[model samples]
Target: MATPLSAERLLTALRDEGLTVHEYREWRTHNRNAKGPWGPVHGVMVHHTVTSGTEASVRLCYEGHSTLPGPLCHGVIDKAGEVHLVGHGRANHAGGGDGDVLAAVIAERELPPDNDADTDGNPHFYGFECVNLGDGQDPWPAAQLLAVERAAAALCRAHGWNHRSVIGHLEWQPGKIDPRGFTMDAMRDRVRKRLGVPPDGGGGAPEFEPFPGAAFFAPGRSSPIVTAMGHRLVAEDCGRYQVGPGPEWTSVDQESYAAWQRKLGFTGDDADGIPGETSWTRLKVPKS
Candidate 1:
């Protein structure tokens, strides 16, 4: 069992981990503690907002709908890698979840599937709502994902817990998947690495494919990789397609790639629209 960190300590821990944190209005005092207990904390829970635009998402999370009440989460991690502190204690993020899952988190052991929702997760977990559409195609920028890893690792470090103490919303609830673009296991690997622990020891290494190279985007290529790249391009707001960045590469893809190149300050022949090793690597497009 772990005790909840004070607001000051939590803020300090996040900052010490190199996160860009923004304190919202009355965030230190905002919470739903009246609804339930907020002690004996177990772990950190990560979730996606399933919304867009940093400002709007932050507001929505800070001030939830009437049905849900405000302070939907303790923090809102924006696309730019900034953490907006919306509330401190007992935020309305994690709902009922499997007690067994919570037990696994406390033990720093591998989790069983969350088949039941009989536990009060809101009181036991610190929650972060990351900005994302939650659709598999929404695209998780590397910065945002890194922020997630750092934030979770920060909490785990403070609590003297391992990466197994971190879990996605999908891992807790019966049928919910807010973070769809990336796998929780891979995220855990990152946190484990940050914690100086071998990533494949307890739960084994995640099987996510490595990022494909620029050659994978060559003309006549019609794999799901192209579609994944297009999704990433669209997420970066560099897509130039009027119809589709479909499986096959077209002039539009070249045009879009050129725009991305220009965005990265490439000029002359360098901005000829084809993906290069550098730009493609920077994009960090998720492997299909």
Candidate 2:
């Protein structure tokens, strides 16, 4: 267990990670600690605001919605990679999630599927909301993505945690997916590479699936491949998904693939939704 990073220390840690942080209104004194306990933090939780535009997203995160209270998260990471500090202790992010996932985070091990929701996560995790449309096609710019990695890495470093200690909201709660464009696994890899440390016995290295060939994506079946391709589409700003890049193929997949082909300067029949070897290789589908 780790004590929550002090606001001062938090700022220092982020800066040490080479980030530009902006202190929002009354951030030092803003919190919801009076409503609950805010200690024994185990890890950082990453989220994406379904809203776009940095200023509005930051303000909304700071002032919250009618259903949720203000200071929705500890920080709002914008498209430029700048971090806007909103709250310190006990932000409103990370609601009830799988207790098993929390346990895995504490133990620094591979996480189990988050199928249950018996745990209230608001009190134990520091949360950061990335500015995005969360529509899978909104595009997570390199700057914003790096800021998230740094933010999570900063907290992990301060708490003596390895990359395993970081998690996405999707990894915690059931039926919730704020972050759509990137994989938490990829983000954790970013943290690992950034931190340049051992895995802290979090288990063996993860296996990445190489491109199985363009023929493998012919649909008629559900698998992690479709989801992986979808992630790559979103990353390349060719995403067309409104829901999940889930295991099964849908029109979203075709549309997203076609968009990617077009972006790559493919035209006419060459821009057909079906992926070719050249485009498939470029997608870099998480090595899978």
Candidate 3:
């Protein structure tokens, strides 16, 4: 329902959301705009490149293979969580998709099942091709996943759209299953939380709450900081709490924090739920 963002705006939005972006060769001027319309964008579309390694994938996307043409997508999200801009307006990604799904996306509501493909998504969506095996076995490292979230959130925020505006290629195409390792729903939840940003662009209205150290989370603790954290966890769809994330430090808080840790790609003892300085810093909890 809006015009496409300028290349400058695209870069600014992404950087504003805290992503490390790499400008590929001729990315600013590269596009398939000559082939069709490329405005009135409705949302963002996600995909997997079904390839391994960053440099090759980015190159392939920038210079697409035979039968697909070149500049296959606007950006290639590498496994390292770096966003490599390959092309600008109207890249070759987001081929035809379900019209019903497109309508739902325009309405910013729950998407209908994509059983038909009578729509040209190329003109209406911004495509991101993420490097992966698409085999479900390839790991989605925490950094990579977080980059996807930030990248998508950046666009949605700029457009004033919500998490609903982001959709997986699988959700748009019939018999397609890209972005396989993580559920779109979960990813949307992460985007929603990150998008909870106010005019200040998150980190609270002014700044994020400081990490209070592990000792501060001892049982029976009561503070608004704990409550703010709980809300953030819930927004991330990681709430393992039985009820309220009240101002008390209950096991519920630990369980929820663990879920967040796991979502960030931590595992085993590292995902043990307790907050570490590194993870805490990344969480960016709003000041109480």
Cα-based TM-score, every candidate: 0.70, 0.69, 0.69
lDDT score, candidate 1, position 44: 90
lDDT of 2 by residue, 1-288 (tens): 566766776886798689999999899889999999987899899999999898999999999989999889999999999999999888899999999999999887899999999999998899999999899899999999999999998887655567888999999999989688999998998898776654644543323346566677676758877876776566455777777668887777988999999988999998888888777766555432
* Candidate 1 Cα RMSD after full superposition onto the native fold (Å): 16.7
The lDDT per prediction is 0.83, 0.83, 0.84
Q: Kindly provide the TM-score of model 2 when superposed on the true structure, using C-alpha atoms.
A: 0.69
Candidate whose lDDT is highest: 3
Residue 234 accuracy (lDDT) in model 3 = 63
What candidate 1 gets wrong by more than 4 Å, as runs, is 203-288
Model 1, residue 244: C-alpha shift (Å): 55
Report the backbone clash tally of model 2.
2
Of candidate 1, the 10-residue stretch with the lowest lDDT total is 203-212
The regions of model 3 sitting more than 4 angstroms off are 197-288
Ranking by lDDT: 3, 2, 1
lDDT of 3 by residue, 195-253 (tens): 76443222222247788998999988999989878756764557776667689998989
